[model samples]
Target: MRIGETAAAAGMTTKTLRFYEDRGLLPATDRAPNGYRDYPHETVSRLEFIRRGRTAGLTLAQIGEILAVRDIGHAPCIHVKDLLAKQLHDLDARIAELTALRATVAEFHEAAAAGDPAACDPERICSYL
Candidate 1:
């Protein structure tokens, strides 16, 4: 398949395919004698896997590591599981931090809502703050 056809089949733009190639996320493809890229049909499947990995919040480097493991004829399932576990742990921590931040902001909002504009200190911007 050609680059455009492969990108369309993979539901991505041609530029994204080129970017993936440049980033080493994709294997090097053969070129036609006229210099256009000639991607294999299996490239579409690989692109889909890359898309799924990105949607799961995996970094390109992490995705690359998984691909590297597979390229070396090994099953990357264990590595993928470990990576997902770490991602989940990190996501939980971020959610906790965001929850605390939301509560603090809500309190500040309540204070602001109850504040009198006339009572705001001139030295500072607002008394509520």
Candidate 2:
């Protein structure tokens, strides 16, 4: 199929298809006489895999590694597990930070609700901010 048809079949934009090609995540099987890209029937499945990997918070480079493993006829389960572990750790850190921020915001809200104009501390910056 042509690039446009492949992209449409994959539920992605043509630009995304081109970008994946450039990143080596997807490669054209051949080129037409008019310079259009020709893709295999399995390209749709590959694109779906890439989309799923991205949805799982994998970066393009990480997805590329998974694709490389697949290309070499290896199952990517172990590598994917490792990547998910790291993503979980990063998410935990972010959750901690957000929890702290929520606590601080709640404290400030309580202080303001207590009718303390000092909570608006104009000498520095807006306390509500």
Scored by lDDT, the top model is 1
TM-score of each: 0.60, 0.58
Residue 111 local lDDT, model 1: 90
Model 1 C-alpha lDDT per residue in residues 1-129, reported as the tens digit of each score: 899999999999999999999999998799999999999899999999999988867789878877776677755577666865776687688679889999999999999889887776677864456
Lowest lDDT 10-residue stretch of candidate 1 = 120-129
lDDT, each prediction:
0.86, 0.83
Candidate that would win on TM-score: 1
lDDT of 2 at 112: 71
Q: Write the per-residue lDDT of candidate 2 for residues 17-97, one digit (tens) a residue.
A: 998989999964699899888898999999999998788667898788767766867455876668657766876886798
* Candidate 1 residue pairs in backbone clash: none
Q: How close is candidate 2 to the true structure, as a TM-score?
A: 0.58
**TM-score result, candidate 1:** 0.60
